[model samples]
Each structure stands twice: as structure tokens, then as C-alpha cells.
Target: MADGQDLMERIGRLRPAVRAAGQPLHRPLLLLWAIAQAVHGRPRQQPWSVVKHELAPLLTQFDGAQRGERDVVYPFWALQRDGLWEVADSAELPLTSGGRRPTFAILEQVNPLAGLPEADYNRLIDDSTVAADALSTLLVRFFGANSGSVVEALRLREFVRGPIGASLLPLVGEQYADRKKIAEAYGGNGVMGITPLADGILAVYSDDKGPYPDHHIPETGWIAYTGDGLSGDQTLTVGNKSMQEYQKQEKALRYWHKPYNGSWTFETWAVVIQCRRRWGRGEDKKQRREYVWVLAPVPSPLRETWPSDVVEALAQDDKSVHDDSVDVIPAEVVAGQESRKLSAQERYQQLSDAARRTDGNRTNRSKPTLVERYMRSAAAREAVIIRSEGRCENPACGGHPLERTDSGQPLLEVDHVNGLARTGQDTPEFMIALCPNCHALKTRGAGRGELQKSLVPVARKLHRAMQRGERRKARPDGT
Candidate 1:
């Protein structure tokens, strides 16, 4: 069995689902927030703004993408695939603007809450072994041989210089403002994270008329990608109709696109879109912005006609490239899935792991696994009582916190109304608080089947009431 230190490294080395060399700075930035959160005395449930403001500087400093601020968008959506964080929203994913992702601004408007898992969140604060291992894993996995400068830039210097940086105190004041540069700049001289595209890449937007290659940019100018594609068109305004009408535009934008005369026979690409609204009446009010994409036919040929700045960036390799082999990613980080029956300890870990993931909603499928359906925790059960206000939800038995425990606490048991043992979900909707007698009648009584059937309406009523109460709080005076 792996020891504590080895497991810590394993957790830190967990990679985000992205392209081989794509730089997803959100992972490291999110990790930093988790660490700093422990250093401070902040709670595990963090609002979107906390991660947003704290992570901005890190994004600006180290994000290798064309626009660093846009980095928050993917983490809000994509980081859910990794098992270390979770979002409060469990609904199906929202629609995208064409194939392009929503910017940071849009995500803030849409998402209400997100955070690290409660167990992991609490552990990183209290456990030095875990924290140190996480730090080491992130450093070695991303920075490899060059973890020192990154440590300084990320404001982990004091911690890094310590015998074991994981024991460093909670950071105070402008935590992300160390202002140190990383060994590599995004898309500039970064040998790792970003894979540089050679000049002369060509992609085409295919119509019945065949591929529409960009022979030259129109007078309006355009944004260039390392691949053969363009950014949102700047010349036109967003949404020609009301804001809702833009949905139709996105569907229209999804026409067939193919690589023109490229080694890869076919290509799959996505379009990014946006809307620019101005104050006006009727049709004059909206302008729809479109960012269409196409794949490149060749890798290193389109140099001459490329934008001057892109050409210049592609040529700025004056500095010696660093060795990426030293980064030391563990083998399991790249392995495909293998399954086995989870032991009781593994069950608890999976529950914690699932809680922290941004995309942790495995039960939304038609036939979710038995384990996936039953991953609940002590906190989750307690939340049911709090949400239920400690009343027996059985309509036939209106039991409150009448019985007192030996500890002088209310005697109530949190029961899975639909029975997780029968493959029911362990979510808030399926849990209810019950007094001892009512609980037995519902779970083990000879008439339990009929009793459970009767309890469904009561459970749903309580769920709806709690939901309404939350909705009111979300909007004061029903505004």
C-alpha cells in the first residue's frame, strides 16, 4: 500500500481533461485557493467571487492561453471532470454560444456557488502531510525542474523555503501579488503547458460551395489562432433581434467544417460566438457576433501571410527551452479506468472526492452505478435534518424532536426516504429526518412498502417548501 506522502503526490498530480500541451491554469490557481483557504480561516463553501478575484492575478501571470481572463470559464465548466472540486448546480449543462466558451463575466452571472470537498477542504487545513504532498505534486507535475520561480510567483515562497512548505502559515494581504514571472510566459517562451503551432496553418469553413479559406483578412482585421481559425468578428454587432433570438444564430453557426488538403483527412472544430447589445428600440437594438473556426491543412507552411504579431511570437525562441521530462507525472494520472468493489474506507473517500468535483453529477444518467447513487456523507445527512427543520416527514406520524438523547440532543435519525440500499439517490431530495419509531415503520415494518409510497408526497412537499424559502432569500421581496 502507498504511504501518506505517496498518496499526496498522487492527488496533486491529478490532471485536468484537456489537450496534451494545453495550459489549464485554473487547476493550479484553484489548488492555490484551496491552500490559501486553509492558511486563512475561510469556510469550505466558497462563493464564485472568492475564487474569481484571488485567481485573477495567477491567471494573468501564468495562463498560456491567448487571453488569460478567459481561463476562468473552462474551470467553471470543465474542471468538474477532475475529482477535486464541485459546483452547487447539478442541472444539465447550459448552452454555449456557438462552440466558443462563455467568458469569465458570463460564468459569474450564471453560477451561484462552487467549492472544494468539505473533507478535503478541512483536511488540507489541518493535515501537513496532505498539504505538502499536494504542493509537491503540483510543482513537479506542472513546473518540473523549474518549480522554484513558480513557487515565488504563486506567493508560495515562504512556504517553499521552509523545511516543508506545507507547514507555512496562512498567507495574508495580496496573496497572489508576488508579481514574480514564471520560467515560461504563456505562448511566448513557455516550453511546457502550451504547444506552439508552426506558421502557415490553414483551416476551412465548408459550405455546399466547399471550403471557405481566409485568403486575406478584410479591412476590419481579425484575431488569429495558433490553429487555422478566427476569433469573434469585430465588424458586426451582437444579436440582430432580441437577446433570446441569439439561440437560433448559434444553431445556424454549427454548419459542417473540414480541413483543407491536410494530412488529417477530417477535423472536428467548434465555433465561439457572442452578442453586443446597445440601447435602441426594436430591431436596431441587437448585434450578433460570430467567431467561426476551421482546421489547418498544413502545419508549417502558412508563414508569409500570417499576422505580423503571431509570426513575431512564433519566432521569439531566443531563450533556451527547458526540459519537460523532469516534470514527473505519475503513471496513474494517464491510465484508463479500472473498477472494483469499494471498501468502506474507499466509499468514504469517493464520497469526499465526488463532493469536491465541479462535474460530479454522475447520477443524471439513465442508469447510474449503484455506488455512484449511494455516495452520501454524515454532513449530507445532517444537511437533510437542517433543511427539514427536524420533523418526521412521515404524513401518518407527525413526529418532531420530541425524544431527547442521552446527550440531551434531539433524537432524530436521517433516513434515505427512497432507500439507498435499493439504489436510491443520496441527494437532498431523497433524504428526510425521522424519529426512531417512524423510521422503523418506514424502513422495516411489514407495511413499509405502502408506508414509503405514502411518504413520497410528504417528502416532495417539504422539498418544495425549502426550495421556495431558498428562492425568496435569493431574491428579496420576491424581486
Candidate 2:
């Protein structure tokens, strides 16, 4: 029988997938949900049918970036790896040929019961002190300053220790002569954009005149800050590390803005609500990896005055990290910006030249935002759509549906042949246009890898055919 300390240690050592896509919370969240169930004296074991129904909403609320039924399936089955969970009818359970858990549909049919083992459940239920210790370990380790909100959300207030929410610095906006003056006021080096100040406050400087220009989304009161690094792709170190740490801890950021011609002015309190890895041109006028942090502006006066939505978003453990480099631009926005028509061959040449120049050694030292990536890849996406000519590019796909978009164009999604995760080049030769159904299947289907493999040659062939002024209308019967 594992004691409370043992359980706390296990919770602390949870091995979530370490990827560029941010840490997955599926396991920790599942354990926390189980702890919540224990607090309410629920049964030790519950079927997947019941657990998914109850846990799906919590997962959706805390893990907003991940969607669909698959999210719930991972935690329910994967938690067993930590040795704290178990499943009934183990031999009877269905699994894939590789001895792994089957799809959620297959698991649903089996409906095996799973949860914390009997001994662990009994310990958590019988001893309130042990349960509180375990809950505190999970909350502090995963939720940080947002633990209080998690407690409230899970109705675990009775099991938590210490006060919730860190004390924030007072609303003080001032003007500084230069970086040195700002550094003297704050604790970190004045030269860096993101710096650590006293009492866990982050000093973020946005210089409009510099290579990285910050953009403000007025609708959400969010600032999309292009992260620090001058020559090449940015890494998780130094100023960028501080930004990530503060984001995970849900600490407030002391923002300052430097206009093109004016002195540095302290802005307002902010928090890094979201962060994404995107391809941006660096100092050498080539595409390089960059981190774009979306900082949410906090209301002034006091933390108590913040709206409920702001508070809730700050409490999310995932922080909605977008790992892909592609910045999705609306089709309408692309059409509006690219009014000058270029032939298929001409558009392909432009993208090819851009790709060749940005071979990782150089990048354009401009502030790369959603608009920048859109302008660069708009031609690539359009060229692929044009090549498809109202037909699905997937050779195996049935005829595209009769549905048309609002503009009377065929409804299709442009996808990279190698996938964005693999850093697929955003060029006409490496892209394909697919109908909505085929696109979804390619993205999330079990055979997506096979499908992606099949599309690679197809995309190349189509681009060549289109260049020869050949229009290959897709067969209605998928011949």
C-alpha cells in the first residue's frame, strides 16, 4: 500500500510528453479528476462511458487547445502507465495489433471500468490529510498560482493549503530616458525585451523601431509580442525562458512600449495568455523559427477587478500553445491583399525563390505577424487551389461534395504534403487542395500518415501538370 508521501512523489514525477507543442496535461489532469472524485466519495472504479461523460467537460475547460473525443481517450488509458491507475477486465480489453489501446470507438464498445486502484482509493477516501497533501502537490506542481481556481473549479477547496493568487505590483506607468533608466527601476538588464523584476514581476519592453515590432489586438486587448533573438531562430533561454516561466506561474508582466521616435513608456499589467512557434524572417531576410507570445492585458487598479473570463483563462495549465509554424490566414483576407493576378508559373517561382533564400542561415529582419506569413504563403495556397480546379487532390478521395463556399468557389482546404509538424515547405510543389471531408480525414484519421505519404507525389504531379496549362477536372466517380 503506497502512503500519501509516495503518492505525492508519483504525482510530482508525472512524465507528460516533452514536445515543442507544450507539455501535455492529460495524465496530471486525469489524476486530479480522480482526486476530485475521491473527495466526493464516488466509486473507486467507473466505466469509460461514465468517466468520459463527466471528465470531458473538465478536460475541455482546462485544455481548450485540444479538441475532440480523442483527448479524453488518452488520459483514461495512459494514466495506467504511472502505476497509480488500473483497469478491470484487463485480458478482455481490446487492443491494437501492436498491443496498444484501440481507438476510442473500440474502447467504448468494451466499456471497461478504470480508476485509482482499490488501496490508493481507500487511502485517499479514508484520510482527509493524505488527500489534501496529494491534491496540494498536484495543484502546485501543475497549476502554480492558478491552483486556487482549479480548487474552486473542482470543488476541492476543503483539501487545499495556503492562500491563492500572488500579490501583484501596483499600477505604475512611467516614462524612462533610456534602457539603462528602465533597468535601474527594474531588476534585470535593461537591454533585453523580457526581464525578471523583483517579486516575480516580468519587465517586457516592446520597441516599435526595432526588428521585432509588437502588434496589439484591440478586440481582445492582447499584444502579440515577437520574442527575443536578433540573428536567427529564437530558443528557450534567457529572456525567452523568463517569459515562459512567468506564463506557467501566471505572473503579471510589467509592460513598456518604445515608440519609433519617443521615449520608453511603461504600459500596463499583462500576462502571457498564449504562445506559438511561427516561421518569421530574421535579420538576414530568410525564414527562421520564432516564438510569438500573446500577452493578455490585465485591467488596472487591482487584481480583484479582473473579469471572470480573464481569471479563468489565466488558470489554464496548457496556455494554448500552437506548435505549428503555419499562421492560418483567412481566404477572404488573402483575396483582398492579393488583387494583382499572377499566373500559376509566376506564383510558383516567387515561392520557390523565397524558399531557396530562407535556407535557415538567413531571414528577413522584419516583425513577422499573422499578416506577414499570410502575404508570404498566400500565393502558395492559391496556386494549389487553382491547380486542383474544383476537384479534390487526393487520388483516393471520392468526388468532392457539391457544396460551395460563400464566394461560389469549391469548398477545399489547403494542406502541406509533408504536414506542418514536419516543417513542410509552404510552396506550390509541396501543397495540395482537398475537400472538407478529405481534409478532415487526412488531418485526424487513423491512416493519415499513409494518406500524407500518398499526397506527396500527387501534389508534385499536379503542380507540373498545371504549369503545362493542363486542366485535369477530377472524376466525379474518383476514376
lDDT of 2 at 10: 64
Candidate 1: stretches off by over 4 Å = 1-13, 16-24, 90-93, 97-106, 158-479
Best by lDDT: 2
Displacement of the residue 151 alpha carbon in candidate 2, Å: 18
- The lDDT for every candidate, in the order shown, is 0.41, 0.67
Find the candidate with the highest TM-score and give its number: 2
Candidate 2 has a TM-score of 0.38
Q: Please, what are the lDDT tens digits per residue for candidate 2 over residues 1-479? A: 76765665466457565456556666777888888888898888888888888777777766663565667887887788787788887767778747766678877888889899777888898888778767755654455545666678888886654443222222355788788876555445767778644322457888888888578853355687988887687898878876887677565667888887888887877777667776566766545678877777765422454666567666653755565444332233334557775555555455455543332322332222332343356456755765676677887786455457654767888888887547535577888988888888888989988998989899988878876767676475643
Report the Cα lDDT for residue 471, model 2.
Answer: 64
Question: Which residue pairs overlap in candidate 2's backbone?
Answer: 282-363, 282-364, 282-365, 284-363, 285-363, 285-364, 286-363, 286-364
lDDT of 1 by residue, 1-479 (tens): 23333334335345443343543556765766566566456776676676666666666666554554465666655555555677776353454667444456656676557776666667776766556656644553344324555666656654443432223122111121111111111011212111111110111223222212222122212211111112322222222121112121111111122234422111222112222111111112221222222111211121233344333332432222212111211112212223654332333233323332412454443211211222223334534554544345554564443566553445788777777556334554566778888898887889999887777666666665654554112222221
C-alpha TM-score for every candidate = 0.31, 0.38
